[model samples]
Target: MAGKRVAGGGGREEDGSKVGLPAMDLALAFPQATPASIFPHSVSDYYQFDDLLTTEERSIRKKVRSIMEKEIAPIMAEYWEKAEFPFNAIPKLASLGVAGGTIKGYGCPGLSITASAITMAEIARVDASCSTFILVHSSLAMVTIALCGSEAQKQNCLPSLSQLCTVGCWALTEPNYGSDASSLRTTATKVPGGWHIDGQKRWIGNSTFADVLVVLARNADTKQLNGFIVRKGAPGLKATKIENKIGLRMVQNGDIVFNKVFVPEEDRLPGVNSFQDISKVLAISRIMVAWQPIGISMGVFDMCHRYLKERKQFGVPLAAFQLNQEKLVRMLGNIQSMLLVGWRLCKLYESGKMTPGHASLGKAWTSRTAREVVSLGRELLGGNGILADFLVAKAFCDLEPIYSYEGTYDINSLVTGREITGVASFKPAALARARL
Candidate 1:
């Protein structure tokens, strides 16, 4: 009985237990608005920020928003429930000509970082999993090849990737090396004509269906980390889908195992000689992660906004109550603050001065804010918030991984802290003691 209260409806306790009342009679009680038109406006209607973009950027934002609302928002819940990627949406998404955004040449859209961040935010406003897929493909995979690959490699891969014919995955996190990726154990040994890879990568997104995978491994002979291009179905390479996840269930993360997987020498990223090169890629990817929490906050705010206006308590609408208004305002303020910082990071990235420390600060701040916003949203929804049917429950569950991935909060904070003070804080206490 405690969990049976219908959303947006008042209930009374009976026989020492809670009992929900019948649905409110809207036809006679409130003649102005109908349930059919209650949600006619998009969630973006609640926020007002027209001066943040130029005409072109605003147009791009509107186009992406329309596509996401019409295509992605409708079926997201079903796909998420089944834990299946919406492969059919690929063509439609590609038709927007935004797959390889932010990069010049190879038929890419060559948009600005602001436009790219807006696209990510709009897509994520509908579903974070879909946004993440795009982020990994464009920011991690294509950008890596563009920045660090040979000219021939770029010419070969960038075209198809721009067209979305080649979905890509980046494999760096191993079964044991998540936050400690610089110390990965995956190894690549040179052979007669190529190289053989042997190791395991866990939590690799899109690997189960990607056309190409960018894998990072240590060279056995030189003992230096390197990046490689590994095509799907390579010999001795296996990717098994990780299932029954509590969050981002539709994204298709995999556990990849490589046993002497053969890759031609040409496939190795020539410019990637050490973990330092890989860090360049991660620095950009972390900025994209900063936008993830923005999306999560948007989702939570939309749900909570709808419920507060409809739900009634003590003969008054919930929105009219001071405490409820305070909670909703606080959530909005937090979102705006997070967005401001994320936008500044994008600007810094565009100016060509963005550092890992800057990206780390944004990622850590926004993710922690998003967690709090979603938790407050769940509290506002009361019992129904825990049910998946309401969507807030899913937002609550999904925020956990976003906070941990792309570098956990503690790691990011230490990164920024060390940069500001010129102190190395990443060493373990025992190691620091030994050094002293």
Candidate 2:
């Protein structure tokens, strides 16, 4: 017996089994608004945040925003889906002149901290993975060289790095020590001409293909922390790509191993004798990390704003619904408050008053707040909220890693708590009480 044709042309056979039809293209099925391919306009600046920026900062922001929209935006979903870095976009990213941020000379831009922080936000506003790539490269690796490297090391390394001609990765976190990175067991032992580094590092962004690795290790003799400039492909040094990441897919994070890798004396960072020296670098990088959520929240809000106005149900735009309007307003409010906190953090750093507590609080609070904003965005998008092409879902996932990195929200809160109350709660007190 022949199959009976279904209502939409799919058929049911005599056995009562249905024959499948080709899946309809999403665009054909939902011919309403477009995906993030043609990025949205900046409507999230509800409080005229531009008024807070200096002329130069505004120019940098504009340049970064334009280039990111034109170049990075179109390719993000594709590369993100593949879980691979878009190596082709390197030149486009480098052209923004935001690399080597706040570092003077050595062919760097030397923009103010505010300008650097703003640039971070702009890049992240489009793609958090791109922002993380640059953060690990410029903010962590290049800044380490600039602040702690010998003059020769800086002269040799910073120029190409600043141009993105060569990429860099900072390796500090280990498989066993992420939040407790200060206790990393990677060791640098004295050798005839240099040091032999041995141990493993994990969750290092850009490590797989990075030309320079700013590796931190313990001094075998003194147990003090030491930093090394390990070149790519050093004998016994191996970086394997980590897979199945739920967020920041475009970043090539890796599990790196040092099997007696040698770092010449010239490559050792003399200024990083103790973990305290690394904190100096972290103090600056954390401020930039704090800006990432600010940018991510902005992007999510803009995406939701456009989506609500464009996508419709019940013969009216989704924006017309009272519930949706409230969510949008809540998202916008979060962005506004996030912008102020991030901006204030920058000002504190500029005045040399920014402490670990200040940077931690900013990163912790903005990221936590942005979580709410992106969640609202995901809700507003409804079914499309789960799709990466829509931007909100991608932003939603990207915000998770940012919330945990630089310092987890809870750890950062404790850091601030310790500062204000003059008591540290990072370690458990139950052990000491039991001993007593």
Candidate 3:
């Protein structure tokens, strides 16, 4: 048989041939079997974990999957090509009742954390930008309201948000503050009738066309970070669409400028007063970020699996090579381990036992693993990997933000290390002062 010799590990003799041979026929052949289907057309087999869901949860997952495959997938590549958001899908997505999957009341579904994870995984498998849009809307925007908004705020915001009648963006990252979100320089000063917000926010997702924005600013008087609901078109609120992103081109990222934007007292999140309140929201959102990479890894895995089986070299399928098989198995193992971690983290969140360190660990581990998986997938595709038609190239680009956002791998590692060691290691040793 003609095939390229793939060298790896110890050699095993077959049919009187030594290991590492170009090809060998096994003496003990069971039978020649037909090739199994590569991947399910419906993606049901891809998400067999649905059996773990409750009846209601399962129904919602199926419905969301249907919407994604039918509505989102067909148009995703086009939008990705043009680097634009599909605002048209909002109405259909809203009709699915998934925007507030795990939140209670005000027209939210109040489902379990598992359901939320499943929804994110399904949407992301088809289109990551679409998944990000929901993740920001449901987890960041709606979860902030659930965790830190007043009853009146929830009642007013949650309904429109659940129905997708209104879109929301969370603005915490400033023009200068990416990793040091707490040190944000945006200022809010109290006026007679309301507060004046002045500052610029960068890399704000969904803000380019969002109906409302949850803005975080430091109070000029108290010097405490505060959250406010700044409606779209508010005076002095300017959102400029950010262009030319190498990844996530389908999602609209924006740079927002709040120049003396006046917001009423009622618009301020009453429960938010200090950075601690903001920490609460970040804690939950970080865990949500963890799942994005898991989904991306799975997408890469599926693509690689299919390509390996279909693409041939030396007149033999690429999957026939032992080295290729080893790569596939390694990728699968990493994906499975990451999925288990994500599942357990979601459980901890549902039980109210989750901490900032837990979110940090999940985000750090999965995001790093996702970057590795995508890199490997790109390598497996050879020269074709760099081409946009292969899709792995896009996955490669998208994983960069996943590894950096929420918190970089280094920052999250230090956070988890501090929790385990019971010591703070945020700054350099030269800056550390000994406790008296």
Candidate 4:
């Protein structure tokens, strides 16, 4: 028998509806090279950076690498395309056992700072967004509590956060103040039982779904920075996800609003009476952030290395061209240098010799260097460079946000400049009051 007439699509006509086309598989569309779904093997460690890590550090690296490639890589591009987090992957991430990085107790792993930093690198190597999610939770939020929270607060929050049973986010930057975070206008007014926090925070990673939020505000009485542990679902607390981001798409960065959100006295962080108090936490966080770019560079280089070998031009492999080989070598050199600088920053922190300048310099330089690495990798991929399925394009976009956050490249450079020059250049000459 003849088939029934179709409306606009296949099969029988029904309501003149169109049938949706099936999604094209990247592999089938581009058969010349494999995408990041089947992640490439790591071949960027040319300088034997592994030897520099301790036994435990190496073990953690291996564990994290395996899970990230096997679990995260397969789903990263999909989620990145959708601009949504893979909520289902939490269990796999928690299994890595590196959360609450550098914290010693309360169900924490108590990893050496080196191990902690290496762990961050390994995570970023596979997906910068996943690494950032963990960084905001562990390095930024959990560390703030560990460094500044009262003993009771620690007892209450750390155990759950360490296991990823509860996620955490730290809120410091406000809508008006990012680089000038110390001048933030969020206010904390003393109330009958505790404090009433009123402010708006922007670009806060994990805030959209964090179980606990560490919010920084100006004390109405003291006029200095103070912090509070604001629970999720608190009255007058709202976190809306920021959308249309070009980078770190898996991370749900949020714009948070607090309208008289009441935090009990016990939830107030006593250590954060002033901005300097949080500066300590920031210095350490900066080191961790520095390692992220290093890891990202590693991933990009690895992706490019595999792509060059698999893809061909004019009947020869891309890797056979002298220019492509030069680009690959340049990327490798950047990664090696970045690795060393990041490692040294950790050591300096461990020895208590690291100053703000040292941390800022490390962060600024490594991120800038990684910028070049990702760019080169992007160039090597040519048309495929713009496709997220191939990994280099995503890394190219991802590196831009990393270059700006945790203090922008210019801000960090000035930080180091001030340390060496003994002159603060953060603000331009003040216009000499216009000489009225």
The C-alpha TM-scores of every prediction are: 0.88, 0.94, 0.86, 0.95
Worst ten in a row by lDDT for model 3: 30-39
Where does the lowest 10-residue lDDT sum fall in candidate 1?
A: 32-41
Model 4 scores worst on lDDT over the 10 consecutive residues at 9-18
Prediction 1 global C-alpha lDDT: 0.82
lDDT of 1 by residue, 283-396 (tens): 777888888888778867877877777777777777898887888888888888887888899889989999888999999999999888888888887876775555677778
**Model 4 clashing residue pairs (backbone):** none
lDDT of 4 by residue, 69-111 (tens): 9999999999999999999999999999999888998999999
Candidate 4 at residue 370, lDDT? Answer: 98
lDDT of 2 by residue, 1-436 (tens): 3445454554655556767776586688777877887789999889999999999999999999999999999989989999999999999999999889999999999999999999999999999999999999999999999999999999999999999999999999999999878999999999999999999999999999999999999999999999999999999999999999999999999999999999999999999999999998999899999999999999988888888899989999999999999999999999999999999999999999999999999999999999999999999989999999889899999999999998999999999999999998887899767778
Candidate 3 positional error at 9, Å: 44
Clashing pairs in 1: none
- As for lDDT, the candidate ahead, 1 or 2, is 2
For every model shown, the clashing-pair count is 0, 0, 0, 0
Error of 2 at 337 (Å): 0.4
Give lDDT for model 2.
Answer: 0.94
Give candidate 2 misplaced runs (Cα > 4 Å).
1-26, 432-436
Candidate 4 local Cα displacement, residue 148, angstroms: 0.4
RMSD of each: 6.7, 4.4, 11.5, 3.6
Candidate 1 all-Cα RMSD: 6.7
Put down candidate 3 lDDT per residue, 99-187, tens digits, no spaces: 88778889998878787887787677666788788888888888888888889999889999999999988899987888888999999
Global CA lDDT computed for model 3 = 0.80
Q: What lDDT score goes with residue 387 in model 2?
A: 90
**Candidate 1: where is the Cα deviation over 4 Å?**
1-48, 313-315
